[model samples]
Target: MKETELRYVLALLRVQGIGDIFAKKLIQHCGGAEAVFTADAAILHRIDGIGEIAIQRLKAPAVLEKADAELEYIRKHNIKVLYYQDDDYPERLKHCIDGPVLLFTAGKISFPEQKIISIVGTRQVTPYGTEFCKKLIADLAPLNPVIVSGFAYGVDIVAHQAAMEHQLQTIGVLAHGLNQTYPPAHRKYCPKMEENGGFVTEFWSSSNPDKENFVKRNRIVAGMSEATIVIESAGKGGSLITAGMANDYNRDVFAVPGRVTDKYSQGCNNLIKTQKANVLTDAADLVYMLNWDLAAEKCKPVQKQLFVALEEEEEKVYQYLNSKGKEVIDRIALECNLPIYKVASLLLKMELKGVIRPLPGKLFEAV
Candidate 1:
């Protein structure tokens, strides 16, 4: 965004009684952020939600002064600002009405046709949860999905570490400003994270990690991903809140089921019992549900492996594709007399074996 426009956006957010939704409404109704300030009072009053108080707040000179100071802080720190209307913003997050109007980022973070998933859980992570998180990320590494978390204790750090271990990009969504790290101990991980995936926040330099800020931050964790996975949680925790937010956003939510006797398993069990989340046994469940396996094939070169072994069902699909060439998955399933779910699993296996390749519009061919 241009410096002038950014200043207006910052000022717009600083105005009392205005938030992301209203700021966006104002920006759109008046053409742009600058226009919102310049719009005539008569025209502003004509808009639905614009009341007298809000219009009066828009005229505050201190708002622009604060914006200028914040803009300076942004520039001095080399922060990257992602405007909601810009293409560079997270596409999934763009759909969220309450998503930040301005997202401040650090490090080299890019969202290029990538599969992004957020993994969140309790701060008191059990050994079982840690192992599950590690194994999940390791298994899903081949598909190369971006791992997102709140950058808190336990499950959050574990997920971020696992992603880094697999050489996958991991993002840390913070409740506080970019100027400082919460929990302070996790400060060591910042440099490494920024090198690859980095940190993102809607908070300003003055903002602190207050209690309510985390609840607000949870929405971003849930909003930016294709799905949100809960490794473990107590009866009522932030991870459950994130799951709730994900459900509200109509995004897939998965919970790793544990023994009912376990203290941390209560939340996951409740979510499953209420049908708010799908039971996640392993990485395959997520891969299958999100159709990520089919999408993963596109990331690789279509080179046929010599003398590759295939399962009985896999051979059927392979034979059909070999003869028919590129075909939709549904057609391949019909021709091979295999179920669609089975076909999807086989296709992913075959792709891993370098026997078949995916095409645009969900078509596939024998490599």
Candidate 2:
């Protein structure tokens, strides 16, 4: 967070072809950013990826001014800047090939070093996609993993909103700068995120939300998490891109399979078929794949019996109802693959047990 180090990091980013990898090397060679600024061209040229043109640009007055301006902008906005060497830098992302030399963060929430999962999918989500995300998030909530995702609509929005509702710390990697929020309609939810979670981006304050930035943003999402989950997507979308990057980074990639005929499910199904991602049918599938042990040693004796009493079918119905938000008896019967009379009787019993409540029009939801 030193001013001199911040300025040099910004300057390094401006140099052509000198990205996070080379920047770290330069920092190591020169001892620090302050020293990097003072080092001669001959010294800079010896480092890999540093060409004559870039070294000259680094020494130029105009380039220095631009770096200074970036610092001034950060100062004016009260933004938090994280350098690669800083302890606060996300450890999962620090080793990424294209990780940013500096990150501009706009909120107070600290990134957790524990299990982190990125949920991504098509911007145009279907009803099934929505329910899948809500259910997955609800089940994962108890594990306390930090949820990461883009702030785009569809799966990203649902993931973030559900995480917030569950009181889980979530991080949104933005396609643009923190100066503005893309899809301005999301402005309302952002403050809630800043209040409860955080927002992050590698772009400078004035950087526009260009088409290409989204591709760049995907790397941050994939690299910063222990795993990536594709809720729904077509063959092409940012979610797929993130999944590919996650694989490249040797991180676990899980995809939710939908009906084979559904366009949104095709991408996920294909990923699983090709062995590019693990098939995720529910939260337990993800938990098992990630090898997450949900067991706690301090639990009350009665709590274990309470959980054991519920049959698998009851748990499925409970989770489905919680995820669906609301559904008619007929719809639940269809979705759960249960007979109408059987579903109706179970619904009444569950209601009496305070597991769910019924509303008008035969709608029911978990209490």
Q: Against the unseen true structure, what C-alpha lDDT does each candidate score? A: 0.91, 0.82
- Listed in order, each prediction's TM-score against the native is 0.86, 0.82
lDDT of 1 by residue, 112-168 (tens): 678999999999999999999998887777788899999999999999999988778
Q: By TM-score, who's the top model here?
A: 1
Best candidate, lDDT: 1
lDDT of 2: 0.82
Give per-residue CA lDDT, model 2, range 1-367, as digits (tens): 7897788788877776677787788888999877887998888878877788777877777767788898899989989988877898899888887788888987766865577899999999999999989988876676677889999988999999999998888999999988898889899998889876789999987699999999999999999899999999998888999999999999999999989899999899989999999988777567546655443232111122233345666777888999988898778888899876567546644543457765655567777
lDDT of 2 at 291: 54
Off by over 4 Å in 1: 294-367
User: Candidate 1: lDDT over CA atoms?
Assistant: 0.91
Clashing pairs in 1: none
